[model samples]
Target chain A: MPELLPFAVSLKGTENAVRDGLAQAMACLAPLHLNTDDAGTVELVLAEALNNVVEHALASTPELTAIEIRGSHGADGLHITVIDCGAPMPDGTAPLAKTPNLDVETHDMPEGGFGWYLIHTLATDVKYSRVGAANHLSLQLPVGV
Target chain B: MELTSSTEHGLQIVTVQEPRIDAAVALAFKDRMRDTTEGGIDTVVLDLNHVQFIDSSGLGAIVAAMKNLAPDRKLILAGLTPTVDKVFRLTRMDSVFGVFPTVEAALTKLRA
Candidate 1:
């Protein structure tokens, strides 16, 4: 008998709780025998997405914030789904992929706004949808490829 | 994040003693960097040789630390792991800062 493929975790969407979520996700991934780089990719992508939800989406409604993280192994690689009942993307629009403005002088270098860029770059097949009150984000990473 | 600082060839080298610079310690890392770099030399080299991971929050903290420095001061990075290096390159932050292969290289550039 083998274990399950898709495992889900429901947690309070708070910045403080992200570490625990990441740990749990890693634990679930431990059996998959992902290499260091692949594992890091998983961790970083998940962290960025979860942090975005906690920081931006759940910023105001901290009381009703609930984040669900689910991971399943697919033929391509590992698949992650993050569902959160937080604020929709401002103006009812999904976030588009935009590169950070790096063409700046030393004095004009940016301090933040690198989160989504990293998320979009590192994860493959990233999709975001605002479903009713929940934001559903799907991302995948191919292992050893 | 824990850091140890020293002055070498007129450049301040701050070594991050932690392995990961994620959201948990990004703020504290920035604060310590500010305190360390305040009223110091104009050029600072951050040693990330020990750091194997850096998320966007960590990157932002580094950028903030750079901004918090006194006028004309620069923050340079050195000894990035492959994973961490990719993060910088992917976000194109590599273009904004001078990233060296080693602390020595960063210092030599400063010295030269």
Candidate 2:
């Protein structure tokens, strides 16, 4: 089984449309026999990434900014890579650090924590990288999805 | 999604329809909660059967409702599918809100 299938979508504005792209990814991976627990894991990882675009990936620009999504799935689990043209990451918050911990809420915490935090906990591997001008986040689910 | 409420055994059950519950609907959801409760109905229950996605703010709105309606009333969450459950858990809303499996179950428990 070739472990690579790709889906790419470019969405405009910070609408709920991001969920559609993600739901597609989850739908594709569902037939691969990932049990109930891992299925929930996949859903959270994708939702958090799509959500980042809605809340933080845009600036004072017209409400026309779009999110780019590229996803793939296979026997070892599903992998969805989200590429968003949001504000430049903050230093170490860049490339890929662990999704900040949202388990403990604090006043100084930035909007960046919970999304990445849930993605990190739900997936066996979560990586964020800045490529060109986009923030690319790759989330891996263990166990062939 | 629109949130509608009704009281059963002193429990206010708020039904939320639609797939995503985020910033746009968060306020409206909260308002309906307050409005209904202020109308002499407390013990709120949010029915999330139709809600497939919920963000931090959405989760926050629910939490806010709890704080705003405490003592006199409390918010209970019901029908959280796996996706919504994960959001609630990751955000720790699950800890703050009393979660139930169904609206009927929530009503029963709240009344007890």
| Candidate 1 to truth, TM | 0.89
- In candidate 2, what are the lDDT values of residues A53-119, reduced to their tens digit? 6666674432666677676776665677777777756773523435444464333233334656566
Worst 10 residues of 2 chain B by lDDT: B33-42
CA lDDT, every model vs. true structure: 0.83, 0.67
Cα lDDT of model 1 by residue, A20-86, tens digit = 8888888888677777778778888898999889888999886587899988876677788999988
Model 2 C-alpha lDDT versus the unseen true structure: 0.67
Instruction: Point to the candidate with the largest TM-score.
Output: 1
In candidate 1, which residue ranges exceed 4 Å CA deviation? Answer: A1-4, A91-93
Enumerate clash totals for all models, in the order shown.
Answer: 0, 6
Taking all chains together, each candidate's TM-score versus the true structure is 0.89, 0.79
* DockQ of each candidate, alpha-carbon based: 0.63, 0.29
